[model samples]
Target: MARYRFRFVACDEGFLRTFAGSAWRGAFGGALKRVVCAMRLRPCEGCPLAGTCIYPHLFEGRQGADPVRLKSLDRIAVPYVFELDDVVPRSFGAGSEVTVTLTLIGDANRRLARSYP
Candidate 1:
């Protein structure tokens, strides 16, 4: 198990204020896919590389994967977990920072470490 910490500063306080937990999660995952996805597909359905793409592997798990290794399972476990502090304020001011801790397990650590800085 390995963990990586990241800090993100909001450029627009107004924008940050609009996000609730669920909305923030959706936006965060969308942005992460955009950052990592090579094909830039709007929906990853039927993507040729879904089995190997880091975006899908981390976010969606392996869909329709062969169950030879893990019997009767459609997808494997999501290899990373997100930890967000509960101390967030109602709204952030400009240049406010948030810390997100990502814990990677199994092959996720090695795969991400080599590709991410």
Candidate 2:
């Protein structure tokens, strides 16, 4: 397993302060999914390649059969874990910074992190 750390600074103080945890997480997930999904399909069900797509497997997760029927086991195990530092301030100014940690395991660790376009 490997962990990557990222630091981000809010450009606008007013905007940063308004974002709560769930709101910020949704935005973050949307941005990450957009970069990873090459097909850019709004709905996963409409995508022809969804069965073999890496983005859905990692983000949306595998569906269908759950033979074991474990509790809350609707999807396959996720390959990465996200950890946001708990001490982050509720608000930020133009220069305020926050750190995010991602722990990658299994196949996810083998993929290289790179800038798209």
Best by lDDT: 1
- Candidate 1: where is the Cα deviation over 4 Å? 14-24, 63-71, 114-117
For model 2, residues 15-71, the per-residue Cα lDDT tens digits are 433324455556666877787676764777667766555565556655323233343
- lDDT tens digits by residue: candidate 1, 29-79: 788788877886567777776665667767777633433466566578877
Model 2 worst lDDT run, 10 consecutive residues: 62-71
- lDDT of all predictions: 0.67, 0.60
> Each prediction's TM-score against the native?
0.71, 0.65
What is the Å distance of residue 107 in model 2 from its true position? 2.0
- The residue pairs found clashing in candidate 2 are none
What TM-score number comes out for model 1?
Answer: 0.71
Native-to-model Cα distance after best TM-score fit, residue 93 in candidate 2, in Å = 1.4
User: What's the lDDT of the predicted structure labeled candidate 1?
Assistant: 0.67
Model 2 lDDT vs. the true structure? 0.60
The segments of candidate 2 whose C-alpha lies over 4 angstroms from its true place after superposition are 14-24, 63-74, 86-89, 111-117
